[model samples]
Target: MKLLLTSAGVKNASIRTTLVDLLGKRIEECTALCVPTAAYAMSGGPGAAWRQISGRASTPMSDLGWKSLGVLELTALPSLDADLWVPLVQETDALLVGGGDALYLAHWMRESGLADLFPSLRDTVYLGVSGGSMAMAPQVGEEFVGWKPPAGGDAGLGVVDFAMFPHLDHPDLPENSMADAEQWAAALSVPGYALDDQTALTVVDGAVDVISEGNWRLFTP
Candidate 1:
């Protein structure tokens, strides 16, 4: 599957170009599934996360747009039963996983039996934002460093071998966050991509490429 791993959303012009470039003419053709991490729905109801993408409540798939589907309002583990989540993945042409807590999303994907559904998602393009990008990596480092531990290891979906360090230079981050990312990347002995806000890492057929207005540093083991 094709992956559009952005540092953040498609806000900046350069990031938009990156998305459009990777998406090609299929931009509108593909269905975008916006999978919100647990943090996205911490306070609001299930429909709240859905509104972040489509600007409307999470109703039938047809009501959203473009013959596609998006999965929002994913808070608790039990909420992702086959009745609710499976149909969306089965019907969609592609999926866009938004940013939040990467570990939480990974755990939910497994507990809800969603990880087992990957093979069936052959036709789906897997697009991911910050936290989503981290989920595609082999490991995200200290899973419980910032939040409480979920059920599993920091192990990601393993869609890609490289580990991604998102929001490298985010304005809201502490001064040492970037340094911490760099150190983590070095210790892991894996290829690392440092994505500043508005940047992206686009992977297709195992090849990795960088896309952004800002700079992205790559670390090789």
Candidate 2:
């Protein structure tokens, strides 16, 4: 599967250009899934969150001539049926995960058995933004918002071996954000990428490439 991991939502025009260039040909053919809010939040009520996510992509996706599935429903653990969701995953040419609480999403992924299901979705192109990107990493560091870290070796889906630190250069963001990412990379003895809003890390068949309008850095532990 090809993984498109972005640090944030599509903000700059250039990044959007890169995205279009990368997927425009197949956009109209893919069944896009937007996991907007974390599953925990959805357990309460996910209507608002779903609307926010779908709305962001509706215009741009339409402009790109992409046929969005408009599947804005939440998948809870008790209600999760692989037969149901897996078909949605398999039928879709691509899956788009939106930004939110990484830990919350990770928790649900594990609970819904999606962590195991993902590897089998090898034919599906996985696109992630912010929390979405972080959810695919082996580790997401300690400062994640809204959820607690897992015990033992339960980091994330481990779809990729490296850790990801998104929103690397937001002006009002904390100074320690990047530092913590660097430190986490060192502590784990693995490679890490720090992405600005417009930057993205693309992984296909285990090959890693960077796509961005500005500079980014790679950290190896």
Q: Give the number of the best model, judged by lDDT.
A: 2
Residue pairs with colliding backbones in model 2 are none
Q: Write the per-residue lDDT of candidate 1 for residues 62-124, one digit (tens) a residue.
A: 232444555544455365456766787677666667666777677666766766877767656
lDDT of 1: 0.64
Clashes of each: 0, 0
What are the runs in model 2 whose C-alpha is more than 4 Å off?
Answer: 12-24, 39-48, 57-65, 72-77, 149-154, 176-184
Q: Which stretches of candidate 1 lie over 4 Å from their true place?
A: 17-26, 40-51, 54-69, 72-85, 148-153, 176-178
Model 1 residue 59 lDDT? 20
Best by TM-score: 2
Q: Quantify how close model 2 is to the true structure by its C-alpha RMSD in Å.
A: 3.7
lDDT, each prediction: 0.64, 0.65
